[model samples]
Target: MGTGKRRPLGDRYQLISPTGRDGPGIIWRAHDLRLRRDVAIKEIQPLFRADGADLDGARRRAMREARSAARLSHPAVVAVHDLLEEGGRLWIVMELLEALTLKETVAHLGHLPVHWTAWIGFQLLGGLRHAHGAGVLHRDINPGNILLTGDRVVLADFGIAALNGDPSASTTVPLHCAPAYVAPERLRGLTASPAADLWSFGASLYFAVEGRPPYPGSDSLAVLGEAVNRDPDPPVKAGPLRRVLEGLLRRDPSDRITADHAARLLSAILRMEGVAVDPPRLPAARLPPDSFAR
Candidate 1:
């Protein structure tokens, strides 16, 4: 079969149609002959042969990254069903989801209702907390990686995620994560950390409520410069959630709000019965002045 034709993988998955592409992987909607169900398969290919890089090493690293993402099991995290090696390619079989990405929703609907954005943030934080506990840092957290299915929110695309303490985690070829959502530390050449994920989460929420990234730019480098040199434009549509976004967007990792604290504020917003009220103040001790000099 050719690249455009439906191809069988092993004895199970039959590739149907291309769903999307991420970095060096081509995602496909496929059918599982044995299970009689649909799955999303990510085909990992070597993109560096033109540059004289090792193809085998790239394949191995992609496999390792898929395995690391499979280790995370949470309702809000997309489930990885299996990994396969066939036809000199690596495939990650995942649950096929039916929903629009948060990015698409924002594009079509503009700013989401405040309560809806809070609900999405709450679920995202839960998923991130679970990943952090499992020693995985989803280095790329943005609107595109967040999906809305019915009333539930799911986080997808773990291609650039890193293991917390593994040395190899830092050495893998970096996939192109959206620079607009990257944390300031990563822009400054620091390694990916949980704090970086939190910063990206804040940017994602900001996008959800404000209809654009905190730092609006035409390209990645421009956005990186803004992220490094400036504070986020204050969120006008965040309503009672403004404080949570403000806390998470702190330039210093040491000063950013903890995931637990963010969860509490979101819970309060969700539980509020009448008109939205400002979330109770987060403890002053946890938030300090920006450590980076102006």
Candidate 2:
């Protein structure tokens, strides 16, 4: 991956075109050569020039993401269809979703209206509750990881997630959107705590309302520094949601709200605003129609 390039397009996928990969995998959108259906493909090479510790960690992580995603069994968590190896490349295929990333959603909406924000928050929390109850900790929760379809919000990108109580799990900085969403303890190589995920959810929703990232600067590193050392500026005119947001974004993980409590809080806000709500769906994401839906 030093060259970081995709494989050449060919007629291998039954003439169906390839899309592209989103994360570490070489993603291609193509017709399943065997299944004969549209699918997304993630290709991994075990012999890439990677740090020794990182190599085994990543391989284990990929296998975990595939299995953890499968066990999630929630409408909001992306479902894994299969994991395969062709030649020297390993791939993971997932369900395709018609959606925009929360990153793209903020770009399009400028800033989400609070009522809609609370409504979406409820759905996100619903998704988290299911995942948490299943003993999965979504360590890499952020805007870009979440997929949105209309008013429906789907949580995606379990690539860097860890199973609860699994001491073998670890965190990857480069894989996360903003280190701000990552728990302070996790930065020190500690295990992920459930409260940390709530902070991420709050920060993600805060970005939706604030337009800019909760901790914005020249780059991810700078934002990370600020998020760790300083409190983020509250969203412009956040009104009553300010307190709720603060509680969720608490730097001390133990002080932050958990998904179940956050869901109840978001529900209260939505009811007060008379906002219509929908059940959260497992929002799917794909590189393209022909290749992978990562």
How many times do residue backbones clash in model 2?
Answer: 16
Per-residue CA lDDT of model 1 for 129-152, tens digit only, reads 777777777887889889899867
lDDT by residue for model 2 (82-119), tens: 87545444567776676888888889878888877787
The backbone clash count of each candidate, in order, is 0, 16
TM-score of each: 0.88, 0.81
Worst 10 residues of 1 by lDDT: 285-294
- TM-score of model 2 relative to the true fold? 0.81
* CA deviation > 4 Å runs, candidate 2: 1-15, 18-20, 33-36, 45-58, 175-177, 277-294
